[model samples]
Target: MSFYFNIATDKTVTADQILEALGRPEVSVDDNKMIFHIPGKSLRGACVYHSDEGYEVGVNAFTPKTDARLTRDVAAAIAWLTGASVVPEDSEDSFSPEYIADYGGEDWVAERFDEAYFLARRPDDAAEGGPLSVAGYKRTFAVTPDMFEQDAGSLEDAIRAVMQVGIDLQTLDDREDIFAASLMSFTPPAAPPQSTLRRMFGLSKPVSNVREPYTAFFIGPDVRTLTPYNETSDPFYVHLSVDQKAVFRLPADDFFAYAEAAGARAYGAQVYDITISQADHAKLMQQAEPA
Candidate 1:
């Protein structure tokens, strides 16, 4: 792994000054971020940190300059060297009200996180038969700050971009059978304002024919609940199969609590915030596979 030093200054500061301050004179500069070589993993985002006022530093698993590697360390180094604090940056303010509002609020921003995080919580196919047939799919979009702003600042559009990007990549890989062979990274570019998401893969519309116990989740204002019959079930669970030997049978509330905890454990991960219905629960349990 490589090491780096970064300094964020409200007032301009030179790269040489930063290295001198850190007592490491042999540092190299890259783009806005800088780098240095340490014996092993050192000064990574997870291990090295500076306050909002000071510089942040870290070591990354990837080549800090390339998408091939990203880690807590790289995040730190970037924040420090570029003088760009991580979005929702502070640990103390990790799950704060502002934090939740920016990411977990109603609209598209919240939805993407909801799918990556909250949605992933619903039980997976932890059964004996193939992956316990959870029959629903997630929509991902490739979004940017500008695109989000243009959609009347609706986060839903951003979410759509991610879904679109994911779909496109999925299709390319499926059709070419080359997705698995490349040592490339699929970092979706930041969505542009008034941007159009090109569909990559998956059904353009919901696949009604493959009906299964399913649930849907979204980030929106007003705690919208999902009823079994409601056309728009926020988190509607789908039932498709059953597991004879269930490992952990948790109540709905407990299940959600577990999911929340799991989401908190992941850094730089998106979690969706939404409500579900009792009917959705029934569907989720319909094909219950215990791990």
Candidate 2:
């Protein structure tokens, strides 16, 4: 899930014009794209693009469940950059009731079922090595709508829950023995049949359709990051069925340190900010400590 707003205007806006409007002299301006460095935001800058229609601005941060103020700020900045009144064209419902209803309450039993589905069908991870590898263990823990309404009295509460889940899941994945056992028990489905013509051309390969378990940390105004495990060393790392959807594997100790820091959460194991309660944070910290 991502949050972005596009405005169509009477006049075409150039990238430089947008940058000047943003009032950041250090912003990098390319042909039709401008990168705005938002302080206290992601290392990656908020991306803005100019087209004949107008300008489309997107925030680098996750969906603004807890704080949509940033998105609003970005929109206002873009409006100023374009020198035209905001004309909405294709705005996504960041917090639609339908989206919230999909959460279906905080059912750990359902989550376990979802985990079991992946374990039985998905291929093993080759990175961790051995027959019982940590290859294809994609698990997710989403902030349910019910969870949001109950635990998260406000947007801030919802964001905290999302961050807490990320820390908790990472800690759970640290158990290599448990991961190995789960992988060993499940048998991957046989690869699909290849056509005879494809076989002759050496293009016959079996493809598995199992998807990674994507934990939705934030449901409303969802945001995501896709990162490679080792870009330099393993640029073409292709072993699992769902390579693109795989989460980055980080060491448990390092992950714990990052997660424990106030307002920190993991999106694909990369640290991001979220406001969590001190009591809840401490409890997660205790669980994450060396056992």
Candidate 3:
């Protein structure tokens, strides 16, 4: 729940680079292994390090507003300096400097969003058994952002991240057409790019996945859409008209309970737990046009 972000890169981040990134901020390297600091308390306010997982840099923020703003800027700087991707702990997707600058900072509430993926839109695309049995997309316990950040290795960890955006969204007008779907599925970090997904559909790759079915609650909404696939087994594609801000991760039992409580439109199976590759992501979410 604290403000911390990881900058993931192919090249390992070293103390030497940390000094360069922050104008050589006073850093105390522990055995030349890690640097842990707190930004404004006169202690190690910022922590920068690389672990065995991959070349990385971890940054934390300040006061809620200051925290979001400052931490975001620093993280973006490091990510770009190192050719890395920033992974905000609360977010379901990785983003760049401009990406974070765009829309939906933390604490942004979703309003007028009343639609449910608890029902099956396309049964053939759903999985066999489970609450989403007839759902077009299907649900999965693996590959949610919190699963990695919280070290959710067991059912308990998954359950901890569960949050039903019920009551809050329940009273809003029915805007199923504009709201991105709740269809979620898991994809590995090295999952195939959109080109491969085009092949999966026996077609061609998409020019953009950030086009429609966006979350209307925000000024510049987060795009949300699924890749080419009529069935559940196809290589899940990029999300169109959808962008990742932050999303909740839930356990199966509780997930089903909430879905039932939400009073589904129809029953079958549908939902998601997805994480796409950087190459595919870049292909999917288009960049802003020059001003």
Task: Give me the candidate number with maximum lDDT.
Answer: 2
Question: In angstroms, how far off is 38's CA in candidate 2?
Answer: 1.7
Worst 10 residues of 1 by lDDT: 130-139
152 in model 1: Cα distance from truth in Å? 6.0
How close is every model to the real structure, measured as TM-score? 0.18, 0.31, 0.27
- How good is model 1 by TM-score? 0.18
Residue 107's lDDT in candidate 3: 42
Rank order (by lDDT, best first): 2, 3, 1
Worst 10 residues of 3 by lDDT: 109-118
lDDT of 1 by residue, 66-131 (tens): 111222333433444454545333242323222332432235223223443222232434222211
Q: Which one is best on TM-score?
A: 2
> Which parts of model 1 have CA positions greater than 4 angstroms off?
1-270
Residue-level lDDT tens digits of model 3 in 85-128? 77766677888755654533544211101111112122543433
Query: What value does the lDDT take at residue 186 in candidate 2?
Result: 20
Model 2 segments more than 4 A misplaced: 1-4, 10-16, 24-35, 43-46, 59-61, 64-70, 89-291
